[model samples]
Target: MEATHRVLVVDDDADIRDLLVFVLEQAGLEVSWAETGEDALAKVREHQPDLVTLDLTLPDMDGTEVCRRLREFSDAYVVMITGRASETDRLVGLEVGADDYMNKPFSPREVLARVSALLRRPRLGAPSEPASSVEEPAPVAGPADAELDVGGGLVLDSARHVATLDGERVMLTPAEFDLLRALATRPGEAWEREELVREVWQGEFIESDFLVDVHIANLRRKLRRAGSRTTWIRTVGGASYLYDPS
Candidate 1:
């Protein structure tokens, strides 16, 4: 049977830990608390929590290092909580692979909202099968569709919704995959933001072009991890980003 959805709350303050546990449990999630980075890692190894709320100031290891190490082992969503609100702090956390951050003295309600959003956000490449069960679908061939090789040691699998880099699977968000496919499919053609909205997003729901930028940034990071560059996408203006095959 699948286990209950778990959240790991890592903070040195016992009161805050208990409070988070109570709130998260009330919100319908299993909760585990750790008082230090080492304990947090151990809990992650033991329970494999679906999400983690990490305190930046750890007694032993720093939160940034903890984040890097955790990413090495799991793809669990991490949200950084700290008293430091410097832009540099936020940037470093993100650069090291944190998905979100919250400042200390934060409202419990806000914390709960962020937790729920992180847990509910749809992940790309997630198994369509029931949770904890492995189901492999039979491969179905695509029609005689045009193939465009996106070099940089990457291969695109539009049919299977997969992307591999140097023979290793590269994980991407759904929006990232959709953006990459849309840009790469046309090779040399540059796509304007509105065009991408109509084509990739299938609607004009996104109000700002930053939506495209955000997804492109995420996609570029994934590609870089695969030892490649997004030399394909070019920025025409604040409103347009184009794809260049070469």
Candidate 2:
């Protein structure tokens, strides 16, 4: 059976809202639309959608504020839509917990593609279950076996989609988790922005380097919040990032 993912489209423009609804519905997703940030929050509370497409400018409040509020009680994937391509704007969106961002004048095809990619990502903090009994067969190793213990009390459990720092759980968006995983898996290797994008976003062509930078910033903030003193992810030159425990 095809999974019926629910998406909440939050935009003030009627044309954009209708267009998003049409495209998302055509893509076999259940979509709900809202014209303001307040309405979007209400709909989110009501529907508990799997994802939300939020516009930066809204009648009641800014999208970043909405995203901040959403993160308080919701884990829904948030994709911010903005007309401005400013680095500050992108960083703010990510800082407030937006999972992704899209610049304005975007194609419905691109929107659908982004939505599909976000939906395909594994849910954060979903842990794997152990065998029921000793008699039960042990699970075979696979991609999940690539888990890493990145020192400084940080552990990345790829199989369970969990990250812990100093024995405290570090909540991360799927993108942030993937980014950390990619860098931690190969510590001390400087990863170019393009390579990190391909690995974390699964080959999606992200046009702006700011996307990767913003997500990295968010990841760092989360690590700090988890009481980490060492800089786990480091910037190399002006272009690449690497995992350096030192």
Candidate 3:
């Protein structure tokens, strides 16, 4: 449970830091703090927390950059906390790999709830090797557990947590893979964003429609970058998305 989890709270405001630390600690979780992005990176490297509460306006660097850097070495659940409550700010934060985010003036209980919900899910794995590094495609093995080789140059193995496109490994974030798998498992089915949130997050978090959209955008981009011959996913009249390997 989250009570046994480790969390790093990164914010320049000492009062906010103290408040978050107190709330998290009261819930029986080990907590730490950092005032700068550099310190946050150092702390993450040293301690490897299960979750991080990052302030978007860090004195040393932008929270998006911190999250981008953190994604390289760790997949800790990042909750970008910001004083700005604009859609553009949320988009930027989500673009950099924040699993979730919230605006300022939030209740500590909500943070704890979000944290508990996030920690309940599997950690998004560390980022894969740079696209330039792979010299050759690894040969695909026999049919895998819960395999979904639906043609169209994409293969998803749910049990093994792998996705291959055109016999080459498709670099995918864990969220992207989960979303792809959910859609691929039931191809041709229109999945509303809310339904995807439930499928991917297992109904642990709500009000995550944009999170689904952002990750879906990322997934489609990666699929194209990986050389899919055609669209493996498509949107349903701007309302939802579905897997369409044709």
Clashes found in each candidate (C-alpha, N, C closer than 3 A): 1, 0, 0
Residue 112, candidate 1: C-alpha displacement in angstroms? 2.4
Q: Note the residue pairs that clash in candidate 3.
A: none
RMSD of 2: 7.1
Q: Which stretches of candidate 3 lie over 4 Å from their true place?
A: 1-3, 124-151, 157-162, 202-206
lDDT of 2 by residue, 168-203 (tens): 789887678778887887889999998776666632
On a 0 to 100 scale, what is the lDDT of residue 244 in model 2?
A: 83
State the TM-score for model 1: 0.65
In candidate 1, residue 223 scores what lDDT? 70
RMSD of each: 7.5, 7.1, 8.6
lDDT of 1: 0.66
Alpha-carbon shift of residue 195 in model 3 (angstroms): 1.4
lDDT (10s digit) by residue, model 1, range 68-138: 88877766778788889676776677666676677778776766656654554323334222222222222
Q: Distance (Å) between predicted and true CA of 39, model 3?
A: 0.8
Per-model TM-score, in order, reads: 0.65, 0.84, 0.81
Among residues 3 or more apart in sequence or in different chains, the pairs in candidate 1 whose N, CA or C atoms overlap within 3 Å are: 190-242
User: lDDT, candidate 2, residue 40?
Assistant: 90
Per-residue lDDT over 1-246 for candidate 3, one digit per residue giving the tens place of the 0 to 100 score: 235678899999999999999888877788999999999999999999988999999998999999999989876778889999688888888777787777788886677666665555444333222111112222122333566787786888755567898788886655676778778878899999877776665434346777888888888887888876688888998979988989
